[model samples]
Target: MSADKPKPAGVKIVDAAKKELMNVSAIERDGNFLVVKGKIFGTMPMTAKLSPEEARKALRMLSPGLVWFLLTFPFRRSPEPPAR
Candidate 1:
């Protein structure tokens, strides 16, 4: 590690699957890995397991605001159901 880049501190493993799925810069040491991630909007941290090609394809499928709108759309509905 260089002075410009600091090392990550190791925390006890929670769940291996959870750890793997987390969005973090990870380091492997002594047969274990430590991951550091940030929470987005108090929700679960978002992680990308997709390859670059897959990610690019996904990004091209939606407009910038479309994803956000779809995610938030369910919450913007009326309290009562619409009559047919």
Candidate 2:
């Protein structure tokens, strides 16, 4: 995609950096770029563009975070045990 083209929201690009890199938590839209948690257990920034559908597809492919997030976000938190 062209540099001028805007990136779709919520897409996670499993590009070379991701493959090379571990322990990443989030992939978010930043301007025209996508910011992913680095494999080094940190954060890595990628400058790429994708369509919304493409973004969603990429997100699903790369990160288990998304799947689990969607799966668990809707449910309420479990209650803690009573104090002794």
Choose the strongest candidate by lDDT: 2
Which pairs of residues have clashing backbones in candidate 1? none
What is the per-residue lDDT of model 2 for residues 1-84, given as tens digits with 9 covering 90 to 100? Answer: 657856444423344444433444456686665656433423644333455677777776856787788788659574575799
Which stretch of 10 consecutive residues in model 2 shows the poorest summed lDDT? 38-47
Residue 31 displacement in candidate 2 (angstroms): 1.9
As a whole number from 0 to 100, the lDDT of residue 34 in candidate 2 is: 64
Give TM per candidate: 0.26, 0.25
Error at 7, model 1, angstroms: 33
- After superposition, candidate 1 runs with Cα above 4 Å error: 1-50, 78-80
State the TM-score for model 2. 0.25
After TM-score superposition, the amount by which residue 71's alpha carbon in candidate 1 deviates from its true location, in angstroms, is 5.5
Question: Each model's number of backbone clashes?
Answer: 0, 3
Q: In model 2, which runs have C-alpha deviations exceeding 4 angstroms?
A: 1-21, 40-53, 58-69, 73-84
Q: What is the lDDT for 35 in model 1?
A: 29
